[model samples]
Target: MKNKKEMAKEIIALVGGESNIDSLIHCATRLRFTLKDQSVAQKSELGKLPGVLTVVETAGQFQVVVGNTVGEIYKEIMEQTSLGEGESSDKGSRRSKGSFLEKAIDVVSSIFSPIIGVLAGAGIIKGILLILTQLELLQKTTGTYQILNAASDSVFYFLPVVLAITAAKKFGANQMVSVIVGLSLLYPGLVTFMASGEPITFLSIPVLSGTYASTVIPSILAVWVLSHLERLLTRIIPDVLKLLLVPAISLSVIVPLTLLIFGPFGIYVGNGVSSLYNSMYELSPLIAGLFVGGGWTILVMFGLHKVLVPIGLNDIATLGSTTIFAFAAPANLAQSGAALAVAVKLKNKEMKSVATTASLAASLGITEPAIYGFNLKYKLPMIVAVISA
Candidate 1:
């Protein structure tokens, strides 16, 4: 509320001032930095900063989770600090692999970093729709309901596009090309082609047993393959024509392959996963809950969650119900409980301040900082919450 400038300077001073940092950037809710020396970072003071949540040193970066206000604070930090120009990425490694403590922090940061922002958007819209529907402001018969539903749903409806864009970058592929590949599977002709009345078979194999829209793994897998193809093309193509030739060839080869092999298989795999999940739920709702509810935070914290998201969406698309979504609800509920527990347990005044903020975030089902910085490190309370659920 005080704006980014005032609070950032206070944090800059706390974390050994601007002098201790080498570079900085931010995501939706975290100020990620590289510090001159971990020893100099005044974690205690940083925790006391007005807007600061907590200082996290993990994932080869110094992280300050600022909830929704991070981007503004990041700009302020960039403006006030004399961090050097764009330089080489300083990839850091922790003390030892044998340490379970280090591995736990690594897992938490790894899982939560990328997925949190998009999840917040989706959750907010969903929450808003829930509010409107309860208030009777969005009637089922009205356009308001349809429009708001579209807003609430597209994140899950056309999720493959979002996954494609992010996963391509994750896999070191050209994002635009990867997005093109993802969208192509949704093309009207392609949908019609796959669902055609004619019996289409390739080498005695059915062309497509399922649709690819809103899927997760296939587009990502295709991009991974395309990235290698791009790298290989990079080696052979003349430097003069590399830019043009690379895209042309990559698209030409990748698109066909994606359609022929990747799209169909990705759809099949996604469908198969849903089928497996359906069987699980039919046997025992509690077992289904145990997998998704107990493991949701763990999965969301790690990049692996992206793999299951498509199946959840696929179930909604095809079957009109999703057990994974139902399961995810309990995990979030447990996260809120664990966050409240941590807020009660931490004694350091600075840590207390961060815990208070994180408790609020978790109550709203935004647990990135709580998971990445505190609950994960402390380990016991978080694990208890998941296991209890």
Candidate 2:
């Protein structure tokens, strides 16, 4: 395989040079680029490059598939370029790049991508804890179990804080200020007060503070609003006072606004979405299964699969298990099977090798390689996989 830096340099050139890049971010397996001119990207050449699995353009990102080495490749690219993380230079081109929903999906994927591994680890630990307690092998109250449980639970419990930092970056807010806002929501004293079931007031006005931990929508909305408020304050506040005064004014206004408005609004919105999904599930689970099974990989193709992650996480946190991942599991397996079949049928040695690798990756729970690299590009196999799913 080529050196990561060599690969990065070639990839950058193939995507119409560093100048063509509007913004760049990476998920577990792909480097997503918002390019100034999508037509300039040499997608076929990029796919053929050493160490690259495939190239996909969807959800407003010119994505280069690099498998496990994506992080290193991303790091190398950043080291070689003036475009720092969370900083975009192609504002003029971005406005015309994609639809609002596509842009929204891009933002969501970028925000959640960095934290997925740890979140998955926490979820796995939570599952193990449940099994141990259920099997009576370990008591939940024991200090050993308690500590391990905290390890499993802490990620979700303080999810708002995690989301805050990432969301702030995506929304172009001050990350430190966003962290402060997140911490304020999860302040120990506030949590205690909410636990005590006491009526809450902030500055003599009634405040509706509740659990902010393990929630997604509220923190994202709060940070978005905070970003605008911060910008406004930055403009009006004197430069001499900007650093100190801006944060003070922003946080003071934001914290109360969040408590009175965004926090409860998010809770209600989340509840409504969960309830609606549950209702759909109840109406006809088989139909729901078929719907997700047939459409899940397609959803993934457009990067819309990320929308399900928070919902699945919330479901696991709230109900102890999730139906979303379960529904998609068969789809993943189907893609694996289809890719393997294609590997056997293909004549070219290189294509066969790539297909085989993708099949293996998909079987092990990473399907992007198989889906984007081969299956989705070939209409028949994609249809077959969806039907099998």
Candidate 3:
């Protein structure tokens, strides 16, 4: 196998060198690049690299699949090239523009990718705590239980604040100002005031009463608006006064706007989507199950699966659970089973090794290696996996 540096170097060259890259980021298993000229990228050659699993071009990204080592590989690429981590020197002007759906997926994936690992860890802790309490192994009234519960719940409780930092990065807005916008939504005083059952107003405009903790859409929408407001402020405000006025003006304007408009609007949108999904599920569980089970991997292939994360998160926040993961779990495990079958029957040593490792990863709920590196490569396995799922 090639070393990380060598692999990174080869990848940079194959993607039309450093100059062609407009920006770069990575998810759990792929190096996603936005290129200035997609035609110049050597996609087939990138797939042939030793460490590379495959290459996929979707959602206006040239994605190089490299399994779990994607983070380290991304680090090596950043170290060896001029490309900034998740930021472009060109400010995205030269990058390929995708359709509205593609742009939405790109934005959602980029905002969530950096935080998914910690969110999953917190979720696991919560699950374990729940199990312990259910089994009578731990008392919810104990100090230890209280501390652990806080640790697990903090992520969700402060989700809007965390999402603000990431959404600011994705939208190229002022991070601190974005954080302030998120914080205002969850401020203790405001929470108390809103919960008081009295009317709330900002400069005579009525503010909607709603909870923002553990919610997803409001922070993102707020930061997206902040990005544009910052740009306008930057242009109109003098350089000498920018440092002082920009943040102050942004917060003063955005906080009220978020309270009066974005926060309520986002909550409504989230509730509407959740209700729509529930109605679909209520209409026919078997059909919904069949489609999500069979087509979830297909959505992943096109990078559209990320579009569902917010919906699932919103459902969890509102409804306490979601059906998406319930259906997806079977699809993932089925792919693992199919890959194991391929591993057992394959005569070629190299292909067999890939299948074996990919199968193990898929069983642990990381199915990209299995889907792209094994099952999808062998058409029969993929078809069988989809049917079985």
Candidate 4:
């Protein structure tokens, strides 16, 4: 068997080497690459590589599916390439290749991927707390419960700050500045003022006060603008003065812009999406459930499921619960069930072992291993799983 390092090197080479790669980011189970030239990539060769489950080309990304070890493989690739240190490198050619929708998906996925694991952990803690409280095992009033609840909710509460850092990385802006912008939005004084229903203004411009914490679009838009503004400043500002001026200017401009424009716009967008989804669910929950349940895995296959993650998160933030996960859980479990059946029925020993492991992983709510590794490999199982979901 090839070691992870060897596999990583081979995977990078097959995907047209470091120079061909414009950027690389990994999700839970795949190393997603934006290549300068996709045609040069040896996709078939990559799928045949040891430890590689499959190759999925979608949303302008060349995704190498390596199942659970994707993180290790991604680390190896980064260590072997310049990508980690080349965040500011020009990617115009790469950017120009994808359609607007593809670019949007790629950008959103990259921005959100780094934090998904932590989000899942926090969510699990919340879920466990809920279960404990419902069973009367833990009182909400207890210190233990309060501490655990804070631990779980902290990520969501400070989500804008967290997202600002990630979005800054995605947009190639100064991370600290982006974080400051996010922090400004959620600053205790500002939040308190907004809650108090007091009028505020920035330089005579009336700021539209709204909740920024736990929201998605505002921080992203702010960081995106910051990226462009930073570039312009770099070009115009004297090199010696830039050290002092760039960040100072960016903060002054972006903070107010975010407060006055981006923050409220994002709030509206988030609210609109949540409202639309809820309205759809209310109109015909059966159809909504059926569509989300049956097609969730399909969306995952194309890396489009991420588009719904924020909506689900927004639903939780605004409505205290979400239908997205409610429908998705059964879909995930159905994949596990289908994989379990595959494990039992497969005659080949190696195949059975793979199916068994995939089954276990899918059961734990990480379904990529099962979907790409076993279920999708067999059409009937995937079809049955979809229908079952």
- lDDT top scorer: 4
- Summed backbone clashes in each candidate are 3, 0, 0, 0
Q: Candidate 3 vs candidate 4: which has greater TM-score? A: 4
Which digits, one per residue and each the tens of the lDDT, describe model 4 over residues 18-109?
88988888988889898889999999998888788888999988988888898898899999988888574343113535799988888889
lDDT of 2 at 122: 79
TM-scores for all predictions: 0.66, 0.89, 0.94, 0.96
- lDDT tens per residue, model 3, 240-340: 99999999999998988888889889999999998988888899988888878888888877766777778888988888899977787788899999999
Q: Which candidate should be chosen as best, given TM-score against the real structure?
A: 4
Mark the regions of model 1 whose C-alpha exceeds 4 Å error after superposition.
1-64, 73-116, 123-141, 199-206, 272-280, 290-311, 334-360, 368-388
Descending-lDDT candidate ranking: 4, 3, 2, 1
What value of lDDT does candidate 4 attain over all alpha carbons?
A: 0.88
Model 3, CA-based lDDT: 0.86
**Tens digit per residue, CA lDDT, model 1, 167-277:** 554445777777887787678886787687676665576654457666665677787688788778888999999879988999888767776788778777777878888
Show pairs that collide, candidate 1.
Answer: 111-301, 111-302, 112-301
Please identify which of the two predictions, 1 or 3, would achieve the higher TM-score against the true structure.
Answer: 3
Off by over 4 Å in 4: 88-96
RMSD of candidate 2 to the truth, in angstroms, is: 3.0
Error of 2 at 114 (Å): 1.8
Candidate 3 residue runs with Cα over 4 Å from true position: 85-96, 347-354
Better of 2 and 3 by lDDT: 3
Angstrom error at residue 216, model 2: 0.4
